[model samples]
Target: MANRTRTPNEGLARLLKQAKWSRSQFALVINRMGAEAGLGLRYDQSAVSHWVGGTVPNPPVRRLIVEAFSRKLHRTVTHAEAGLPLAAFDQAPPGVDTVEGIVDLGRADMDPSRRGVMAAAGLFSAGLAVPVFSAPAHATEASPVTPGKQTVRIGAGQVEAVRRMTDKIADILDELGGAHARPMAAAFLVNTVVPWLRAEASDTVKKDMWATAADLVYLTGWMAMYERDHGTAQDYYVKALKLAGRAEDHVTYCRTLRGMSLQASNLGYGPLALKLADSAAEAAPKAGPRLQAFLMGQQAHANSMVGDHRRARSLLAETEAALMKADNRRESIGGYNQSAYAFHVSHVLHEGKDLPGSISALQQALKVMPSNERQGRVHFYAVLAQRQLEYGHLEAACESWARFLEDYEHISSARGDEHFDTMRLRLKPFRKAQAVRQLSPRIADVALLKA
Candidate 1:
């Protein structure tokens, strides 16, 4: 336990207040759990207070505490459920000034200890504060929508039009995956979709239009990130979130936050990823089952990166439960939403080094995902190869990598290239193997790599 760090749960008091669980009630819950576990440990209000007042319980008790509340609330809770699980606090949530939030999230991912601290807190303190944008700004006079494009204003007809456009954009992007779809999506959004959104329109129309614009912007941002344009992509996500807020589209807002979370996690910001995921979950507590499940699943993904298997598993269970209970009112953001859940779970399992579990989850994900969704398919195959690598199946990893490269080639995406290259580096140990060497040439030929 040399690397064992202590964290205090700050949100414990808040959860207690929300659930109306007094000190005695909390003690009762803990004592009941202890008795159930055959600990024979007597507990009471004072004991609970002492534990809550900065004393760390053994790991068993800690897990039990989380489970106890999860059962009581009929929802998943983390160690942060009790209070801040650790001693440190993260910087306040990002302001809407620019891509600052995205950068902050990136910083958090690179520091595992910070990740632990933020996950321990688990409160959407950011949502409670004033939003970074008070009044939406107009386009600057010199800044055309895009090079020669005219400035667009927000309106009703434009909103409806943008919605239709976004649907088409998403479809095209899905087909292209991370490769060809990246620039196509960005061109469409920048030259057409976003301009339509910023153009003149009534409040009602503007809101509707902004919703569509937000979705498209998010898609573009994700595509850009995949294409390896992180700077531009971060700006797009921030802008998308701002637009989502203007439209009062909580579901999309939450989803964009999750997207930011994914980016953070990918870049190694575990704490920021968890925080952003938490923000999404909090944004729409009543956002029906599907949306909630999606948010929880993303949080689970962030948890897995830090080797927090227990919490990750618990969240996945809750996510599955929520998804199962999701009603017919599915406000899915895109066609990939359903399959994305399974894909993400598989990803978490893969990262956790659980090959069998990863394979099982990936199968489920692939079952729902169409072969045409190149980026998603590439990811699925790439992860499978990672699992193969774990099992000393270099040949299998090579095949998967080859297929991944094939799908990856169909898209204009930088992120896809990064993933492909990262896997290549990991498989370098097998370079002497003819199979790996044979695949290396093809991977090297991918256009993004050439660029």
Candidate 2:
């Protein structure tokens, strides 16, 4: 037989040419897409050249290329049509892809060694511009089944049970801290929720299950943020938002965006944070009073981060006003109220360098915060100590630090540890002061243990 020559990926090249994107531009788009999907791809024109020369990209990269082209052309594109090898799961339809994605995420979360998933999970600044308010494209259809799996039955009762379990877990998260509850949350999602999602159910039951799943996933993201795993946290939040969209639960969807805003602001990505917060508020204009207060407070905090003191203060006032209109109803799935509003006030004041004002706001926060909220108490105490020290109230600072240590000793939190390290640095300047001298040994002892 005569030898045959292999053909290049002319389809991809043709698409790129039609899109008016140079090889480098196409590569840049692909790289950006990969980053948004939590993959760290460093492709340039050379990579594109290889692709055009018949070399296929990896599965994730192939999907990203198709996605990039789809975005550029404003139409859906597929791997096979793009002349790329299909992913193992690509044979399934869109709804199945979503379910499998969640399942994969849950499994990765359960395994600490899967650092790629965790690392890639960071909040991309570009995501702030993406619309999260609209319903997902696949929302109205039934989720396609995985091949060869038995059609396990699910019902509203099962979904209700999951909802109740989610409530109990959320309570535990509120009282203890994410450090204590995060593993449990991940495990539950992997072992319980993922199975329910894969099981067969009627449309109503499926929708309810998706809503409950969104709530649980949102909680997981919050816990991840608490632990300072920003990447993983961002990933979970994105998933929760998608699930919320599927369920047509606008409230949870908006709340998830707000959570993303909170994480971005905390990480000092001020501009993106402000944008996400604004989007969240705009998405849920008719939301309840507590939810409105929470969103407004988030906007205020983001404004503070971006140095818009005037806007921040105005939003803070609005947040307070909104809180007053909140009903006495039990906390909804993702609701916030007076204490949360006060805490956000403290954040804004602190960011704006109003130490005394921040301290006062934090005091109010602690006053209204639930007594059993151990993690909340610790956070308030930590901030209070820092503000007291900054205001040169050494004695009061020491007292607050003592209280912080008392609460912090029982919880594992990266945020708490960051505060502790900050306190140590702040206290170094006052080593010779009587109050500092008295508190030094205790702080040092704790630091030593942590180290």
Candidate 3:
């Protein structure tokens, strides 16, 4: 018998070299990431050697490997880059019904065993497609319940319950942060909302129920996004879109799309954000003034991100005009106020490279923000401090950071934690400054508590 030669995976080998991690070290890091994703993987150096020696990993396993490298290198590493097989998520497939998908996604979000993989490794796709608003009724309708499936009969009161619960969750989110509110939302979906969806009801009542559920789910997804759980957030957003579409609830549908746009913009997907934002606006051509302001503000941010300064400025002007025309009825789900409007103005100015103007706008946002919105204040303070530092205003930055720490101590949030870490790093090089000295002891105390 003749001897055969095996081709090595040059791409993986190249990445391993760039990473400067020994095979064993690489295996350990990947194992830790897998545990976070709920995949109790136990690969050692030998397993890694095999992959580098041209052995292909399964798709899920491949993504795990890619995520590990992406985290290590602080950049995205695709399947092809690692010489692995392509995954189905590259082109998302659609098949599940509205109610069934909601139940499945909500259950996964609620359980640690399932959510470990889902939330910890939440996927953010730059290639996702938004559902068209004008799809035929038959195309977007919920599938008929199978015979023998246990179901209940629901009414308008049940729909109102869902709506009220959603508002309460939003309040908790603003006060205590998503860490405290998301689980409540997940429980509500699985226990209360799912039953209502499966229940028998008049057509009008059913539509109302679906629209209400969609609002709650959209809110849940928004909280996930705030927590930096992108994959879980994306899943919830998609389900909300379907639920809204099935009910022909154009307002909820547009609101959901606007939420998606905000997520995209935050993650630096400028074009996708713009596309989703435009879709949101176009879908509801006759939207009320507040909704118009809500959608246009995001569109302006996306435009600024994409370097359309002229268009972004134009959009900002229109957003202000529409906001002025809107009545005092603050929408619970898709609310837009002067604070939110000013926040968008700050975003546009910052993205347009007008730092001084942006800082001024941010100050206005903070000034008008509701006193009860402490969680939002935590985020705003951190940003203001960082930007103040950037603009060489050391004392002002320290004052802003002091405010951040005050609210930060009371909140339980992954993002707030991240901001705390960043605050420490930013202050490290300025230890000799008087402002920095005054802030150090409090910083140490907070660090101990957070630890």
Candidate 4:
């Protein structure tokens, strides 16, 4: 091979020296960061040497490098400050900058082409790990008031109205899926909620408004994830976390962190997922029983993802015990019950390779799950089909899939579509069987409709 020309990365070298990290140590930190962000990077000392020689890592990895340095120095480190080119999108802002950042995100999401760019963006582990309040002095400071605009006055009643509307929208999302309510939620945020934030109000009312906005934004993030727009979902969750922090609402902040953990775990970043889940639980030690159960259940599933079978089982038991302590108030606040616990238990068992146990837990989940949770019902049914197929029960799997299709036809979710595609591919080999033959044409019909 011809000798490769090596350029110098003086900035990276200086930073590495300041941080007192060896080439191998730097690469190891980057690898851990990548794992937290749901990326499976396998860079070694050679990768660090290449970087020192002016070879830039991929965009996501470059971000990880900056984040690692930020953590080491206990300060915000920009890409340019770390010897890298500025990213196309500005780094996510904290405190008052969060408002502007979210507005930009909303606009981008509404643009078809820009939305595609966000949808295709990779996960950033540092984004999930760092708290917004930990940014540099200016970034964490409160926003300044702008004059000359009509001072739209806001009060407690207005905040209550927004909260009630958000609750109604959340109900719709649970019953019909994000495809049916995401647009409405987005519009409400931009048109109604943003204005209230800009309006004049007492400090107490403003705090309440921020808390309510955090709730709505978090819901939007949840809907985005369900729609398979991971990047946008991450942005929304981060913004929600900032708002919750500003309002000093520990419960909402922990809930937002838990949401991030769930998204990270589902995308296969087991280590990062576990970190986020544990962080949520740690942040809310004195939370209600229902919330505790939900957080512990999430931790259990994360443990399973990382192959900690014994710990996963123990957490699952603790989750059940927590649920047993929930009263009506706790249940209403957490929005979790026996069925929710069952669903999480099923997930943990499935991840731990207990297919039979998973199937039984899923059955229990379906029996107790409320009919209003249509989207969840579809998900559970699909998983039931998958587990049956894995166990070589072709006929039973077909029956479960048929039930899934019945519910799926009414929902418009990218996740549901993905499951349908996976089912089609898996069933291809069984086409000669009577059940598969009959289901194949119907599957094709659904695909065509989706297209």
Ten-residue region with minimum lDDT total, candidate 3: 89-98
In candidate 1, stretches whose alpha carbon ends up further than 4 angstroms from where it belongs are 1-156, 193-200, 326-338, 423-434, 437-451
What local lDDT score does residue 311 receive in model 4, on the 0 to 100 scale? 96
Return the TM-score for candidate 2, rounded to 2 decimals: 0.75
Residue 274 Cα positional deviation in candidate 3, in Å, after optimal superposition: 1.1
lDDT of 1 by residue, 1-451 (tens): 5854434445666676667899898888777777776676677888767675666666556656655665667543444446534222122111222222222333333333353453444322222222332244332311111111223455556656666666665666666654455445554554455335434555566566656767877876676556545555566677777767666677777888888787777777788788888777777647767777878998899888877888988998888888888765423253325577787788788778778888777768767776557667877788778777787778877887887877777765445656776886797777788997788778667844557
Sorted on TM-score, best first, the list reads 3, 2, 4, 1
Q: How far is candidate 2 from the true structure (C-alpha RMSD, Å)?
A: 11.3
RMSD of 4: 13.6
Angstrom error at residue 155, model 2: 0.9
Separately for all candidates shown, the number of backbone clashes (residues 3 or more apart, or on different chains) is: 40, 2, 2, 0
Residues 1-451 of candidate 4 have per-residue lDDT tens digits of 9888866888889989989999999989888877777788888899899888888876667767876885686544445656776444344222435665565566555544454577777444444444643322331133323322324788899999888888887878767777767777777787677767756777778778888888989888888887788878988988888887777778888888888898988788888889989999998848878888889999999999999989999999999998899885522123778888998898888887888999999989999988877788888889889999999999989988988887788787777888888888889889999989888777877778778
Q: Candidate 3: which stretches are off by over 4 Å? A: 1-96, 111-116, 134-144, 149-151
RMSD of each: 20.3, 11.3, 12.6, 13.6
lDDT value for model 4: 0.77
Q: Considering summed lDDT, which 10 consecutive residues are worst modelled in model 1?
A: 141-150
Predicted candidate 2 versus true structure: per-residue lDDT over 1-451, tens digit per residue: 8756557998898898879999999888887776776777899999899999898777667767766775577544555557876566554444545554555566666765564557565544445444355454443353544323334788888898888888877778766667667777787886777767757787788888888888989888887887778877877888888778778788888898889988888788898889889988988857878888888999999999989999999999998898889887756356676777888988999889888888998889888877777877888898888788779798999899988887777766777888888888888888899888988888878877777
Model 4 steric clash pairs: none
